[model samples]
Target: MISVEEAKRLILENTHVLDPVEVNLEESLGLVLAEDITSPLDLPAFTNSAMDGYALRSYDTEGAHEGFPAFLRIMGIIKAGDTANYELKNGEAIKVMTGAPVPPGADAVVMVEHTEVQEETLVVKKEIKPGENIRYKGEEIRRGDVALLKGTVITPASIGFLTELNVKRVRVYRKPKISLVVTGEELLAPDEEPKPGKIRDTNSVTLKFALSREPTEVISVDRVRDRKSAIEEKVERALRESDVVVVTGGVSTGDYDYVREVLESLGVRSIFWKVLQKPGGPLFFGRKDLTTVFGLPGNPASTLVCFYEYVLPSIRIMLGKNNKFPVEVDALVSEEIRKKADNKTHFLRGYIQGDGKHLHVKLAGPQGSHMLRSFALSNCLIVVPPDVTYLAPGSPVKVHLLPEVFL
Candidate 1:
C-alpha cells in the first residue's frame, strides 16, 4: 500500500490529457478552454446611449437652469435598434432610448427627468457635460483582444460574456467517455425483490448520480457476475472502447477477485494497487495507453470515498484542469474519537457546523466501511492522519468538504 499523496501523484503522472476539440459555444458549459479566445469584434460595436434621454451637443445644455431653461427643436426619436441617420444641428435634440446609437454631432445626453417635453421641443433644465451617459465603442473589449485565456473554465457568466462577443464556437478539451462495470454475482438491481444473501446494487447508481456534475459522458454501465470469464469479457470491452473504466468490487485478495488479474492480462500497467486509507484500502489504478481504469471497493461508503479521493482527481487531470483535488477546509472536531494503532489513515463522515471564527464538526453516524447511512448525512470527511490515534473535542483537523452533486 502507498500513502494517499503518493497514490495521487502516480495517478496524475500516468494520465494523458484528452486532445482539444472545437465545440459549439452553446454546448461548452463546464468545459475548460484549450486555446486563448480573442474577440472577433469590438464589444458594443458602436457608441450608444446608456440611458433613455435626449442626445444633443454639450453646448446646448450649458447655461440651462431650472428657472431659466433652454429650448431646442426635436429632430426625431431614436429608439433602441434603430439606425440614427439624422444629425443633431445647433439648438436641436434627438429623443434617444437606452442602447440606441447616439446621432452624429451629439456629444452629450440630458436625462429626461431633468427636462420637460414641450410641443415639438425639449426644455433642458440642467447642464450636461460631454461624453455623459454614452457607452463608447471598444471601451470594454477591442477587436482581436484576448477575451478569455486558455484553461479558463466556462461558466454561466463566461457563456454570457462569449455570447455578447458573438463567439460561435471554442476549442476545449473533450470530455472523457466513462464506462462503469459493477462486479459481483450476489448483487441485485434496485427493482428486484430482496433475497436472503443478495443485496441491491448501490455502487453503480450512486456513482452515476455522483458523476453527473463532472464533465464526462457515461457510455455504458454493466454488471458482471463474479466469474473470471465474465469479468474479463466486460472489462476487456470497456478498456477497448472507453477513455476511462471504473470497476467496483473484486479488487481485494479474495478467491473470486479477478479485476486486478484481468487488467494485467489486458496489458494495463499498474500505477498503484492500494492506498493506506480506511474504508478503501483496496483502491486500484491502472493505465493502458491513454485509457485509465479504476478498481474501487465493493461497499457503498468505501466506493464513494475512493471515488472522491482517487478516481475524481484522475478525471480532472484528463480534462486539463489545474486543481485536481476536492476543496479542503480547516475545521474543529466537536466530539472525542479513538482508534487503534494501524498503518492506514482514517476518514470519518462528518457534518460541519458554525460559520464564523471556526467550523465545528461532529461524526455523522457510524464509521464502519459498509455503512451508507452515515455518508448520507455527511457533507465532509474529517481527516485523521495515519500517526494519530486519539482525537479530543476542539482538536484541529483537515476536512475535505464534499461537493453537492446530482441535486
Candidate 2:
C-alpha cells in the first residue's frame, strides 16, 4: 500500500490545467473564471441617492440637529432611474428618491422622515453630513479595475456584479468529460429481473450521482460482464475519448479482479495499487495520455470515499481550478472511537450536530464499507488516522462535509 502523499503525486502526474472557453453569462455561474474581468464602466454609473430624502450641499447641514434645524428652500423631486433636472444651491434642498442621480452641487441628503416640508420650504431636524445616503460613481466597481480574477468560482452575487458591468458573457474553464464503467459477471441492469446468482447493478447509479456534483459531462456508462477482452476495449475507449475514466470493482486482488490487467494492457500505468485508508483501501489509480484512470472498489461507501478524496480533486485540477479541496470543519466527537493504532488512514461515516458555532459529530450507525444504507444516513466523514487507538468523547476531529443542503 502507498501513502496518501504518494497517491496524490500519482494523480497529478501528466496533468495540465484545462483551457478556457467562451460561454454566455447565464451558463457561467458556478464555473471557474479563466481570465481577469475588469469593469469598463463605473458601478452605479453616476452619483445617486441611497434613500428617499432631500439632497443638500455639504455645508448646509452645519449645526442642523433636533434643536437647531436648517430650514432651506424646496427644489424639485427626483425619482429612481431619472436623470438630474433639479440642482441644489446653497441653503437649498431637493427631494430625491432612492437610486435617483444626485443633482449637481448636492453633496448630502437628509431623509424625509427627519425633515418637515412646507409648500416651498424644507425643515431638517437632524444634521446630515456630506456624501451621506449617497452612492457615489465607481463606489462598487471602478473602471479598469479587476472585478473578478482568474480561478474564481462565479456565484450569484458575482453574476449580478458582472451584469452591472454590462458583461453579457465570460470565459470559463470547460467541464471535463468523464467515462464510467462497471464490471461484474453477476451484475444485471437495474431495471432487469436478476436471475439466480445475478445482482442488479448499483455502481453506475452511485458514480452518476457523485460525478453529477462536479463540472463534468458523463461521456457514457458501460456495464460489462467479467470478461478481460470487453474490459480492455472499454478502458481503451475511455483513454481515447474521456478526460477521466472511473471504473467500479475489479481493483482488489480477488480472482475476478481483471481491471488491473486490462488497464495495464491499455497503457494505463498504475501509480499504486492499495492505499493506506479504510473503506477505500482497495483503490487504485493510473494515468494514460491526458486521461486519468481510477479503479474504485465495488463497495458503495468505498467508491464514494475514493471519489471524494481523490477523483474529485483530479477533476478540479483538470478544469484549471486553483483550489480543489472541500471545506473541512472541526467537530467534537460525540462518542468514543475505537481503532487500532498505526500510520494508516481511516474514514468513518458520521453525522454532524451543532448550532452554527460548535459542531459535534456522532458516528452514523455502522462503519462497514459495503453497506449502502448507512451511507444514505451519513452527513459527514470522520477522519481518523491509524495511530488513533481511542478517541475519547469531546475530542476534536476533522470532518469532511457532505452535500446536506437538506441537513
Candidate 3:
C-alpha cells in the first residue's frame, strides 16, 4: 500500500483540465473563468447625481447657511433615465434625483434636506463644494480594464457586474461527467423493508448527495449484484461514456469481490490498489485511456471518506480549480485519543468549537468504518498521521472541514 500523499499525487498527475466552453452569463455561476474578463464599457457611463439634490454652480451657493440662505431660480427637474437638454446658468438650479445625469455647467449638488423650495425659487441653506454628491464617469471601472482575471471563480456579485458590462457569455472550463456503480448482493433499496441477513443500501444515496455538491454531471448510477459479468458490463459502459467512474464495494480480496478482477479484465491499468489509511484502506484507483475509476469499500463511512479524499480532488482538478483539496485548519483536541500505532493514517469524525481565541475539537462518537451516525453529526475529520500512536488533551491536530461545513 502507498501513503495517502502519494496516492493523491498520482491521481492529480493523471488528471487534466477540461477544455474551455462559452456559456451564457446566467449559467456561469460556480465555474472558473478560462480567460480574463475585460470591461466593455465604463461603469456608470456618465456623470450622475449620487443623491436626490439640486444641481448648480458652487459659486451660486457660496457663503450660504441656515441663518441667511442663498436663493436661485429653478430651471427644471431631471429624473433618472431622462436626458437633460437644458444647461444650468448662473443663479440657476436644477432639481435632480438620485442616479440622474448632472446637467451641463453644474459643478456641485446640494441635498434636498438642506434646502426648501418656494414656487420657482430654490433655497440653498449650506455651502456646496465643487463636484459634491456627483458620481464621476468610470469612477468604479474604466473601459478596457481587466475586471476579473483568469481562474477566478464566478459568484452572484460577478454575475451582476458582468450584466452591467453587457457581457452575454463567458468562457469557462467544462464540467466533468461522472458515473456511479454500486455492487453488493445482500443489499436492499432504501425504501424497501430490510429482511433477515440483508441491509438497506445507503452508499448509493450518500454518494449521490456528496457528488451533488461538486460541479460535475452524474450521467448514470447503476446497482449490480456480486456477479463478475454484471460488474464487467457496467464498468465497461461507464468507462466509455463518463470521464470518471466510481464503484462502491467489491474492492477487497474476498470470495465474492469482483471489482478488481473485472477492472483488470477490461484493460484498466491500476495506478494503486490501497492506501495507508483507516476507514478506506482497500481503495482502488485506475485508468483506461482518458477515463479514471475508483473502487471504494462497501461500508458507508468508508465510501464517503474515500470519495472526499480522492474522488473529490480529481473532479476539482478537471474543473480547473486551483485548490483541489478540502479546507484544512489546526485545532486543539478536547480529549486524549489513543490508537494501535499500526503505521496507518486515521480519519476520526469530530466536532469543532471556537471560543473566540482558540478552536477546540472533540470526537463526535464511535469511530467505526460502517457507522454513519458519527459522520453525519461531525463537521470535520481529525487527521492523525501514522507516527502518532496517541494524542494528549490540548494537542494540536490537522482537521479537514467537511464540504457542507466549509463550502
Candidate 4:
C-alpha cells in the first residue's frame, strides 16, 4: 500500500490537462482561462456621469448654498447611452443621467437632491469639488491592461466583468468528460423497494451530484453486475468514450471484487492499488494513455471519501486549477478520540463548530467506512496522521473542511 501523498502524486503525475477551447462568454463560467485577457478598450470607454443630476464646471458651483444658490441654464437632458454634444460653459449645466457621457468642460456633477428647480433653471445648494461624482474614462481598467491572467477560474463575477468589457468569447480549458461505472449485483436503484439482501446504489447518486460541482461533464452512468466479463465490457467502453472513468465497487478483497482484474485485462496501467487511509484504504487508480481511471471501494462512505480526497483533485488539476485539495484548517478537538496505532492515516468524519477564528470539531457518530448516516452530517474530515494514536480534548488537529463550491 502507498501513502496518501504518494497516491496523490502518482495520480496527478499521470493526469493530463485537456486541450483549451474557445467558448462563448456566457458558457465560460467555472472554466479556467487558458489565455491572458487584455482589455481592448478602457472600461466605461468615455468619461460619464456617476449620478442622475446636473453636469457643470466645479468652479461655477463654489459658494453655492441654500441661502445663496447659483443659478445656471440647463442646456439639455442627456440620458444614459446618449452622447453629450454640448459642452458645459462657465455658467451652463446639463441634466445628465447616470452613465451618460460627461459633457466636455464639465468637471463635476451635482445630485438632484441638493438642488431645487426654480422656473427653467436649477439651484445647486451644495459646494462641489473637482472631479466629484464622475467616472473617468479608463479609471477602472485601462486599455491593454491584463484584465484576467491565464489559469484563472471564471466565476459569475468574472462573467459580468468580461461582459462589461464587451468580451464575446474566451479561451478556456475544456471540462473533462467523465463516465461512471457502478458495479454490484445486490445494489438496487434509489427508487426501488428494499429487498432481503439488496441495498440502494448510493455511491453512483452521490458521485453524480458531487461531480456536478466540478468542471466535468458526466457523459454516462452504467451499472454492471459483479461478473468480471460484465465489468470488463463496461470499463472498456467507458475508457474509449470518456477522459476520466470512475468505477465504484469491486476494488477491495472480496469474493466478487473484479475491478482491478478487469482493468488489467483491458490494458489500464495500474498506478497504485491501495492508499494508506482509513475509509478508502483499498482505493485504486490507473491510467490508459490520456484516460484516467479510479477504482473506488465498494462501501458508500469509502467511495465518497476517496472521491473527495483523490479524484476531485485530479479533475481540478486537469482544469488547470491552482488549488486542488480541500481547504485545511487547524481545529480544536471537542472531545477525546482514539485510534488503533497503525501506519495508515485516519480521516474521521467530523462536524465543525464555532467561528472560523476559533474552530472546534467533533466526530460525527460512527466513523465506519460503510456509515453513510454519519457522512451525511459531516462537513469536514478530521485528519489524524499515522504517528498519533490518541487525541485528548483540546488537541489541535488539522481538519479538511469541505469546500462550499468545488471547481
Candidate 5:
C-alpha cells in the first residue's frame, strides 16, 4: 500500500531512457530529439531588401525635405532573386523589389509608392534616414551558431525554421514500437454489440488511442483469455516484437487476476503491485530484457488514470525524453466536497475555471470507475490525499490537468 508519490518515485527511479536513432525531418514531429542541432550556414545567407523601394546612398537624400523633392536617376531594377549589379552612387538609385539583395554603397531606401518613376528619373516625396529599410544579413541567425538545441521537440513553427535553414533530414529519437494487449473472457470489442455475458474490451483499443497521441508505432493488439499460460505466451510474443507492452486486466488479487503470475513466468522483474491512487490501484510493472510491461486495471477510469500518470511517462522514456511529462498544479476548490476516506488516495474528475485571477475547480461528473461518460467530459483530476477531511470552497487541492474539452 505505497502512496502515489512513492509509487511514482519508484517507477521513475527504476526505468531507463531508451537508445537514440536518426530519423528524417518529415517524420520528426512529436518525436524527441536524440541530439542537438546547429545551423550550418547563416539563416539568410546574404543581405536582402525588406521592402520594395529604391536603393540609394543616404547622402543623395540628405538635403531633400518634404516640401523640397529630391530627384535622382533610376539606373537599374532588381527583383527578388536578381542581385543589383550596379552599386548605388551619389544621386543615383536602383529599383528594388521585396527580398532583393541590397547593393553596396546604399544606406537607405525610399518606397516605390513614395517615389515617382518619371521615365529614367525618380522623384522622392520625403527624406529618409540611413539603413531605414535594409535587412542585415544573418539578422535571424548567425553562421556557425546553434539554431536549435538538442532535445527540443520539433513543432510546426520549428519545422518552418528548420526548413529555412535547409535541414532536410533530422536526427531525432526513434519512436517506440508498442503492443497493446487485453486479457479477459467477458470482454468484447467496441465494434461488436455486447452480448448478455460479454462487455466491451475497450482497454487495449482506448489505450492505443491514448498512446498514439505521440509518434509511437503500435505493432498490434492481441486479445488473450485470463488463463496464466495464454497471457504468458502473448506477453512473451509482444515483448519480443515491441519496445514496450501494455496489458489490461488480470493484475489484481482476484482468481482471474493472473497477469503478474504470467509476467513472473516470463522471467520479468516485477517493480510493484499497487499504488495509493484511486481509479487505478492495482498497477503491475516489470522489466523483461529491454522491453517494459505495464498491467493496468480493467475499469475504464482506472485504465485512463494509469495511462496518464504512469504509462505516458514510460512511453516518454521509450521515446527518449528526460524531463518531458504531464504538468500538475494546485487548484482552489469552488465548493466543499467530501467522501469516505480510504487507505488509498482518491482522484475525482473536475472542471477548472479562471476568473481573471486564481483558478477554481468544480466536480466534472461522477467518481465511479465504470463511468466513462464522466471521465470523457472531465478536464482535470481533484487529487485528494489520505486522512484529509472534506474539501471546502477555496481550499487548495492538488490537480492533474487534462486536455480541455467540454460538451
Candidate 6:
C-alpha cells in the first residue's frame, strides 16, 4: 500500500488534459476554457442611459435645485432599443428610459425622480454633472480585450458575459467520458426486494449521482455478477469505450474477488493497489493506454470517498482544472476523537456548524465503511493524518467540503 499523497501524485502524473473542442456557448457551462476569450465587440455597444431620466447638456442644469429649477422643452421620448437619432440643442432635454441610447450633444442625465415632467417641459431639480447616469461604450469591456482567461471555469455569469460579447462558441477542454461497472453476486437491484443473504445495490446509484456532480459523461453503468468471465468482459468493454472506468467491488482479497486479476489480464499496469487510508484502503488505480481505471471498494461510503479523493481529481485534471481536489478548510473539532495509531489516514464524515465567528466540525454519525446514512448527512470529511492517535475537543483539523455541499 502507498501513502495517500503518493497515490494522488501518481494519478496526476499519469493523467493528461483532454484536447480542446469548440462548443456552443450554451454548452460550455461548468467547463474549463482552453483558450482566452477576447471580446468581439464593446459591451453596451453604445452610450446609453443607466436610469429612467432626461438626457440633456450638463450646462443646461447647472445651479439647478428643487428651490429654483431649470425648465427645458422635452424633445421626444426614447425607450430602450429605440434609435436615438435626435440631437439635443440648448435648453432641450430628451426623456430617455433605462438602457436607451442617449441623444447626441447630451452630456448628462438627471433621474426622473429628481425632476418632474410638466406638459412637455422638463424640470431639472438637481444639478447634474457631465457623464452622469450614462453607461459608455466599451466601459466594461473594450473590443479585443481579454474578457476571460484560459483555465477559467465557465459559470452562468460567464455565459451571459460571453453572449454580451457576441461569442457564439467557446474553446473548452472536453469533458471526460466515464463508465461504471458494479460487480457483486449478492447485490440486488434497488427496485427488487432484498433477500436474507442479498442487499440492495447502492454503489451503482450512489456512484452515478456522485459522478454527475462533475463535468463528465457517464456513458454506461453496468452491473455484473461476481464471475471472472463476466467481470473481464465488462471491464474490457468499459476500458475500450471510456476515458475513465470505475469498478466497484471484486478488488479486495476474497474467494470471488477477480477485478485486479482481470485488469492485469487485460494489460492494465497497476500504478497502485491500495492506499493507507481509513474507510477505503482496498482501492485500485491503473492505466491502460489512454484510459484510467479505478477499482473502488464495494462499501457505499468507501466508494464515494475514493471517488472524491482519487477519481474526481483525475477527471478534473483531464478537464484542465487548476484545483483538482475538494475545497479544504480549517475547523475545530467539536468532540474528542480516539483511535489506534495505525499508520493510515482517516476520513470521518462530519457536519460543520458555525457560531458566527468560527467553524466547528462534528461527526455526523457512525464511521462505518458500509454506512450510507452518515455519509448522506455529512457536508464535509474531517481528515486525520496517520501519526495522530487522539484529537482533543477544539483541536484544529483540515476538513474537505463535499461536492454536494457547495451545490
lDDT string, candidate 5, 1-407, tens digits: 78888777877876666677777787889777777778888867778778999998877787676678899988888899986677678889988888998888887878877788788998888788888888888988987788887778788888888888888888777888889888898987778899999998878777878877778999989888888788888888998998888898889999888888888888889888888778788998888888888899989889988888888887787676765456677789998889776866888888887787888888988789987888777788888888886998999998888644332
Which 10 residues in a row give candidate 6 its minimum summed lDDT?
398-407
Flag the better candidate by TM-score, 1 or 6: 6
Best by TM-score: 6
TM-score for each predicted model, relative to the true structure: 0.92, 0.93, 0.93, 0.94, 0.92, 0.97
Q: Taking the candidates one at a time, how many backbone clashes does each contain? A: 0, 1, 0, 0, 2, 0
Q: Each candidate's lDDT (Cα)? A: 0.90, 0.85, 0.93, 0.90, 0.82, 0.93
Lowest summed lDDT over 10 consecutive residues: which window, candidate 5? 398-407
TM-score of 6: 0.97
In candidate 3, what residue range of length 10 has the lowest lDDT sum?
398-407
After superposition, the stretches of candidate 4 with alpha carbons farther than 4 Å from their true spots are 63-69, 405-407
Scanning candidate 4 in windows of ten residues, the lowest lDDT window is 398-407
Tell me the tens digit of each residue's lDDT in model 6 across 236-355: 999999999999999999999999999999999999998999989999999999999999999999999998988999999999999998899999999998777889999999998788
Judge candidate 1 at residue 384 and give its lDDT: 90
Ten contiguous residues with the weakest lDDT in model 2: 398-407
Which scores better on lDDT, 2 or 4? Answer: 4
Stretches of candidate 5 exceeding 4 Å from the true structure = 63-65, 111-127, 403-407
User: How does model 4 fare in lDDT?
Assistant: 0.90
* Full-model lDDT, candidate 2: 0.85
Point out where model 6 deviates above 4 Å.
Answer: none
